[model samples]
Target: MTMRSRLTTNRLFLSPFTLDDVDELHAILADPRTNTIGSGPFTAIAQTEKWIRNRMAAERDHGLRWYAVRQKATDVLIGNCGLFRGRADAEIGYLIHRPWQGRGFASEAVAAVLDECRSAGIGPVWAIIRPHNTFSIRIAERAGLRLARIESDERGPLHYFVTSRANT
Candidate 1:
């Protein structure tokens, strides 16, 4: 789907990231809690800008993009969620700001994005989560993705959760 298309739920609106979103998105990315399982929080605003630029390019060149997740009421960006080209299939990923976690915002955003993927005929979405990331594992399971297998890379064990698909 095009970047103009937005995915919505009762509490969130998922829209494409724009250059203007750098400030707010950087706030979330700068928080250590949001990057516990990944490369770690961004240390500078330039990194956040580069990230937005790269995501925009991915949308333009590869039809893969991350949507900025915002609270519908206040229009504040709280996180991001989207489908990305994965090793085996399209993968879903999301990050909710620390203040917004535990309130079901991540789960809602993930469900909305998964619905969008399914509507676009994308199947067998995967959530390759670090084994120790119980928060994301629970979110994946809540979004109807089940643990398919566990694999290891240089980062260590990863739990590969896949959507319900016959081939998987």
Candidate 2:
């Protein structure tokens, strides 16, 4: 029963994540292809749940929001998108299931999340994509997040992108 002013697109909805979404998320984690593009333990559902749960518990935004994506027609869970409190900025990230990839779903989900960030009064929402993750870069472009920086993470330095009100 969580609610927010941000509205994901009508064809699909990006609403706050709940514990109830465990099963859908489990499937996403269990698939190697999805994890490879999105990054995770492809064959382990429990591990995925733990990872998401820990993210849910993050006080980064003083516990602001995380969204689980669902289709409008069938309520089929597709993926997730969220705004996290980074060291000096707010960032958005998303992952689409293998079945949903290359279908323009990720782009749509990001649009929904950026709209959410706007409603939340966050400026210049950022995203960090692995160099090879072109799908994410496409979504970021659709959402108006431009390439801002290219720095490394624990995994490696990445192309850090940003979407701001000016760009939108």
Total residue pair clashes for candidate 1: 0
Native-referenced Cα lDDT, model 2: 0.72
With candidate 2 superimposed using the best TM-score fit, by how many Å does residue 107's alpha carbon deviate from the native?
Answer: 1.0
- TM-score, per-candidate, Cα-based: 0.92, 0.83
Clashing pairs in 2: 151-157, 152-157, 153-156
lDDT of 1 by residue, 1-168 (tens): 543368889999899999899999999999997766568999999999998888787777767768999999999999999877766657888999999899999999988887777766667789999877898999999999999899899878888999997422
Candidate 2 residues 1-168, lDDT tens each?
122634558678777665677778888767777777435555666776776676676524254466788878888988877766664466787888888888888888877777766665666778878888887788887878888778876787688888765743
Who wins the TM-score comparison? 1
Q: Give me the displacement of residue 11 in model 1, in angstroms.
A: 0.7
Off by over 4 Å in 1: 1-4, 166-168
| Candidate 2 Cα outliers beyond 4 Å, as residue runs | 1-6, 37-39, 59-61, 86-88, 165-168
Best-fitting candidate, scored by lDDT? 1
